[model samples]
Target: MNLMFVHDVRSETYNEETFARSYGYKIWEERYLPVFNKINVCFRNKDTNVDLNGISDKSSGPKVFFDKRIGMFKGPDVFFSRRIKNILRENIRNNDAVIVRLDSFLGLQTISECRKINKPYMIELVGCAWDSFWNHGFLGKILAPYLFLKTKIEVKRAPFVVYVTREFLQKRYPTKGISTNISNVKISKQKESDLNGRIEKISRLGNKIILGTAANVDVKYKGQKFVIEALGRLKKQGYTQFEYQILGPGDQRYLLDMARKFGVENQIKLLGSYPHEKVFEWMRNELDVYIQPSLQEGLPRAVIEAMSLGVPCIGSDVAGIPELLDKKWVFSRKKDKANEISKLLKKISKEELKVQAIRNFKTAEEYDYNFLLDKRFKILEKYKDFIRREK
Candidate 1:
């Protein structure tokens, strides 16, 4: 059967080649392509000027619908455009099944169209748009309630649901029909092996701990500010041996400025983006502590990856973090997380850290792609059976 996936992540251009090269394609190739006879993706195309050079020029397997213009939320021109409506209507009619990545306007419209046409569809609740609204700024606060309410209603309509985080998202977006927890992150055998050696080294580390976190600095909600504050507090307390590393791609001006203000500039380093392989190498070999102080998350992949490498993790007690971290490692986001995190740093013993690292590795094993695939396959099978019975 033909499968259609709808999301709001804008692409540079609309071409089969670019679609094939995108991260979305990798996900579809791994998870859905095997099950469906053919796969199609519908998303916004940002090539408003029609730059042919910007468009991908290679061959691709899955069909793509990049008819929608970018900036749906910026104004009404694209939001109320007939082009988007026709695109969704046409895709819904052509596809045998639809999977809407929820909380985005595009996903909402696609699911609504699917319902109108009596099409079978499911929801992939990857992130909380409401929580995002709360964290990002004034705009997010304004849109959070509407998106949250809309998603709650749309979720009930979906015949099946796939939640990225088992506990966090499931609690917020409850579904009436079949549902399963399938995380998006996966680790390979090589990665596991790389982690094994690094685990022993980190397990034997001394008083000089190396703390690290990987996240885009552009995401204000990541709580890098809190981390820098915690480091400053630690420094003031004479805990000066540890070093902090922040990874991922983005302008570091804000973070750098904040670090300097806190007088912990020398304590932290902003390491830019690296290949996944390199990231794992550093997580496995170079880091002692992993911090994910995000104000919100939907089962953070970076935290899980660090845990999979046998690195002890500390994060905000929000979303799926508690499911991964013990209470001692989690701090309240609303409170002075800096003070709480500093206490954990000062109080946690080396032996305790080692034990936690071992425990983390075990927890991460449960999220391995192979394990998640089995659960996902079962859900898909159930959906297929449900569809067959309907006929």
Candidate 2:
């Protein structure tokens, strides 16, 4: 059986010969390949102005393909082009199932066509559509409420739904269909998470405190901006004992400008995005604190992994973030997140940091890669059974 996976995550071409993805297709292939004979990863291409310089993955085998032969313009532009319509239509008609990663424009279009053609379909809700659009700057602000409602309506009618968050997304976009919650994060048993070493890092806090997060520098919603603002706030309060680092790929010009305004430009470092395998090593050896300052999120895998590595962490309390954090560590509002993050920095102590390190590692223990993969497979198996019956 062939599975069609439709999501709005845009793709970029580095050399024009192949497409690269920041999030990569390898993770999706790993999840779906076991359940189907083949999987078609149908994603959008980037807009003309924005580019992230993405890395490529060598995941395609005899069983799967990146079928972008479905021409460009994945929007109302589809109405103007016959070529775009036919390729998309054939992919839908030939595939045994369509998995729409919801609340995205491309996913909406894919689902609309699936319903019209009476094809078997399923939903995988990853994050809040409302937050995604609302935090997405000007164009997104205007579309936020409308998109949120549109996504909510479709989710309610979906026949099978999988949520990355257990509570937050379900409350916002409830589905009447058979449903399950399985986070996309996958940490493994073989990897070492040094809780004792983390305790020692906190012990060495007599020196400068190093705070780090993983997010693209240019993306405002990733919430690194607030961390910069908070760093500035701390500087004003005469706490120069701090260094902030971001590990993700993007143009850092805006961030540098923001840091300069706060007079803390020298304290911030931008480490370009690293391969997933190498980043954990960085996290384990380098970080004193891991902060997920996202304006919105599903269960953030970075925070969970930081926890697994016994890194003391804090985040803006949005989406599934609160589910993973203690109430005391979470900041409730975006407008006040800078102030909130500043407050947490002010009060951080050796005892509290060690306690959190131990606590977070214990909680993150449940997310080992093999354990979550089994849960994901169970729901997919149920979905495959549904597809067989539909035929």
TM-score of each: 0.86, 0.91
**What is candidate 1's CA lDDT for residue 137?**
84
**How accurate locally, in lDDT, is each candidate?**
0.75, 0.79
Question: Which candidate tops TM-score?
Answer: 2
Task: For residue 165, give model 2's deviation from the true position in Å.
Answer: 0.8
* Candidate 2: tens digits of C-alpha lDDT, residues 178-289: 8998887867773343887888778877868889998778888998888899999998889888899898867989998998988898999988777676678878988888
CA error at residue 80 for candidate 1, angstroms: 3.4
Runs off by more than 4 Å, candidate 1: 13-25, 44-79, 189-196, 203-207, 385-391
Query: Per-candidate RMSD vs. true structure?
Result: 4.0, 2.9
Candidate 1: pairs in clash: none
